[model samples]
Target: MVLIDRIRYLLEKLLEVFTIFLLLALTSIVLAAVAFRTFGSSIAWYDEVASIGLAWLTFYGANLAALKRAHMGFPGIVSSAPPALRMALFVLSEAIVIGFFAVIAYYGYHVFEILAWDRLVSLPSISLTVTQSAIPISAALFIVCECLTLPEAWKKMRAGVDSEHEAIEEAIRLAEEDLKENRS
Candidate 1:
């Protein structure tokens, strides 16, 4: 269990770093494209490349959000439920999330396989599979993030912890801190 936790921690850190890099790269690409177009010079493949970068950014961002337990959910009923009911609901909700991503990963892989031979229209050198691969990759990453957090979530559920409320409070605290830092 310790080893698993360590591995999860490492993977989460790596994913976070990668997501940041992707964000920077996506921003640069879009900004560059806009600058070039404004100067009356346009890169033919800029739009296609930017779109692919956006897809990668979104997918990876979702994976990071899942790892951070930042995804939105209706927690009112769950938070107010009895301990046993809360635990049951938590388990059911997790199952749904995990199952949904698993199905997407499965189908996304198939889609990738089918489009593997195709190439991007504007960027003919790049295969469609390369961009489409983000779908399954992100789904798998999300599953891993959920699985890594499952033990802690289970413990909280057993202890009747209002995770949703806690998460909201945490977000508010972080936001306040950010505002303070900016004002300083």
Candidate 2:
């Protein structure tokens, strides 16, 4: 693949690894927090740490979802539309989603800056800045992934299918058409 493709691949891989690590970390933290609370011992920072990890995990997972087209939507609407209208709607929806996420990424950057300067009172253990950094980082990554996915979606919308999804869709379409023709 080309440089940009390679970069995207690497980012995706890194995000995948980060998501798994964060999930495991969050799970462990939750279990430990439960144990501590049960024993009448409190770890003041556990909640904050878990929240931060969960936020990061969620953002990365959202990006992964977008990349895989795993984000939930009402498929029946799109599937029922005529092809041209469906394509237009698909492109429009993707554009709207990208624009919304772009705004989010912008605000996330501002939040990160503010966090960097401000300290959390309860957990002076880690700077609020560090915790806030994950927002912008994940938002930026999400934006990148959405942008990368748009063209592929558009291509699929227009061309019916491309190298990526063509084989499977084509196979299914052929089978369905054959069944219909045979029935007729």
Candidate 3:
């Protein structure tokens, strides 16, 4: 259990770092493209590359959000429900999310395979498979994140804890602390 927790911690941290890098890369690519165009020297592959970067950013950002449980949800009822009901609802919701991502990942793999031979027009050296690969990769990441939360959900359920509310409150508190620190 300790090993699994450690692995999860490391994976989440890695995802966080990768997501930050993607954001920075995306921002830099866009800014560079804009500056080049303004200077009357546009890069032919800038659009294609920036689009791919944006796609990757969106996919990986979503996966990171899942890892943080930052996805939007109407958990009001669940948070106020009885322990048994809350547990059932949480489990059901998680199962649905996992199943949805599983289907996406499966189909995404097929899409990536089909596009493997197709290259981007502006960047003939790069295959479409490379850009489209983000779908399956992100889906897989999301599935892993969701699966990792299952044990915690089960433990909370067994302990009759309002984990959803607790998590939300904890996030709010952290945000407040960060704001205060920044102001200081």
Candidate 4:
């Protein structure tokens, strides 16, 4: 369990770094494209590369959200049920989510075969598979994050204190403290 927690911590930091890098790269690409166009020349790879970067961002961002257990969920509904039913509901939800990502990863892998001969229009040297690899990679990352955090999440859910509620309470407390400090 401690091992998993450590791994989760590392994964979180890695994702943060990668996502920040992607954002910076994408911003630079757009700015360069705009500067070139303003001078009466357009970049051929601007649209294609930017779109790919955005897609990768979405996929990886989803994985990060999963790791944080910050994804959309109805914690109130689950917590209100009896303990037995709540456990079942939690299991069912987890199964559905994990199953969805599994299917995505399975098909995403097959996409590489279909795209093997295809290359980007703007940059013929780069294969579409390279850019599209984020699909399966992010899905797998999400699964890893879910598994790593499962034990602690289970304990929290069992205690009738969902992370969402806890987060909200924490946020409110912090905001109130800030307000008090400002008045002083």
lDDT of 1 by residue, 1-184 (tens): 8987897789889988998999899889888889999999988988898888888989999988888777887666777788878878998999999999999999999997689789989989999998899999999999999998888777766776677888779999999999999999
Residue 103 lDDT in candidate 4: 94
Backbone clashes in model 1, listed as residue pairs: none
Model 4 segments more than 4 A misplaced: none
Ten contiguous residues minimizing lDDT sum, candidate 2 = 159-168
Better of 1 and 2 by TM-score: 1
Backbone clashes, candidate 3: 0
| Model 2 per-residue lDDT tens digits across residues 72-142 | 66445664578888877887887788788778778987876656767766677668878777766766777
The candidate scoring highest on TM-score is 4
Report the lDDT of model 2 for residue 90. Answer: 81
For model 4, residues 1-61, the per-residue Cα lDDT tens digits are 7888899999999999999898899999999999999999999999999999999888898
Could you estimate the TM-score for every candidate?
A: 0.88, 0.75, 0.86, 0.96
- Given candidate 4, what's the lDDT at residue 40? 100
Residue-wise lDDT of candidate 3 within 6-29, one digit each (tens)?
877987898889989988988998
What's the C-alpha lDDT at position 125 in model 2? 65
